[model samples]
Target: MKKKLYLLGVFILCVVTLSGCIPTSEKKSDTLGLESTDRYELLIGLNDVGTGKQIMDTQEAIEIIKMKLLRHVSGVTITVSNGYYYVGAFIVDEATLNCVIYGADDESIAAVVNEINSDMNVSVLVSKTPSKYRLITP
Candidate 1:
């Protein structure tokens, strides 16, 4: 009887531990805000106006661009990376925008690009391609 009770207690402890490891259905559903059907990539390039041109801080610019992009598409994932433009032996800093836009159409993408161009001082280049992978937030 004592051995059976000990085994039962251990079994109950194991079941509770395993249950905690399992994710709730609500959490799984909340993983992504966008629909999985259609997605696109938007790559924006930023450059200075001229040799002596001044621009906003790199991080500030990235955040500003991200906020503007989010306004157009709420579920999009925006990632920013640093890039360099080589002018002869000189290297210049450039801000690169990598956005995974969910459920985006050509018209919506074009509109976002136009908005970015008008709001930012940096020259912008927009590229759109169907996304092959889903954007996951960490």
Candidate 2:
């Protein structure tokens, strides 16, 4: 009986010790490249939609657009300049997709022309402005 009990305890100790020694998985994911985010830095020139004259050259404008786009995400800071805008959006692993709108809260480009949307593209109205400028992601 003593031998059996001693063997059982040793087995239990080995199992416990070996379990802690196992290595954990360190896997990453790749879905949408846009979703992963980058040290993204792009410039959007503010030219008059009509005359093509430069209206504003500002990092502030870029910062505003960056903040508006990534307000709900984590680990992002946008810098704007007079000549162009700079963006570095870092999405946390927990972020989820949602339609985000900013500015006069209008779904129109008039509310936010000369601005860059999340697709990292410039947004301009072809005709009369819509109700608001919106960013939608899957």
Candidate 3:
């Protein structure tokens, strides 16, 4: 009886110890050239809609755009300089800059864009790049 009880305790201890080694999430392989689908870069440029110059201040426009973007993406990096905007975000497949900047059917994205457009008369140029392509930041 003593020998059976001792063996049972040892088995339970081993099972508990090994269970901790299991991973909770899928691990990425170290294979070279593995592409990441979740990375993207967004560039936005503000320019005069017509022959006249842009009336809104460049810095203020940048801040307004930044705040709107933050509402959709959590860990986005946004910077603006000389009427140009740069945004870097991960896991941003659904919430795209073009969708947010240009009015889209998506309610969340459209709301932000419409608000900005209504306040400013400047035209916007939006560009999106995949993760493989590197963007030149200012």
Question: Best-fitting candidate, measured by TM-score?
Answer: 1
Q: Which 10-residue window in model 1 sums to the lowest lDDT? A: 27-36
Off by over 4 Å in 3: 1-35, 38-40, 81-115, 132-138
By TM-score, the better pick of 1 and 2 is 1
TM-score of 3: 0.39
lDDT score of residue 82 within candidate 1: 66
lDDT of 3 by residue, 30-100 (tens): 55544433343344445444534455566676677787766755435655544333336522111112322
User: Could you arrange the candidates by lDDT from highest to lowest?
Assistant: 1, 3, 2
Name the better of 1 and 3 by lDDT: 1
**Cα lDDT of model 1 by residue, 27-126, tens digit:** 4553446444456676666665553243676677778877787777766667878667787898876667777776667777777778876776455655
Query: How high is the lDDT of residue 71 in model 1?
Result: 70
- Candidate 2 lDDT by residue in tens digits, 28-127: 5434232321222233444443443444434444555556545433333333334333335632121111222323223333333333443333333223
Clashes by residue pair, model 3: none
> What is the TM-score ranking, best to worst?
1, 3, 2
For model 3, the run of ten residues with the poorest summed lDDT: 91-100
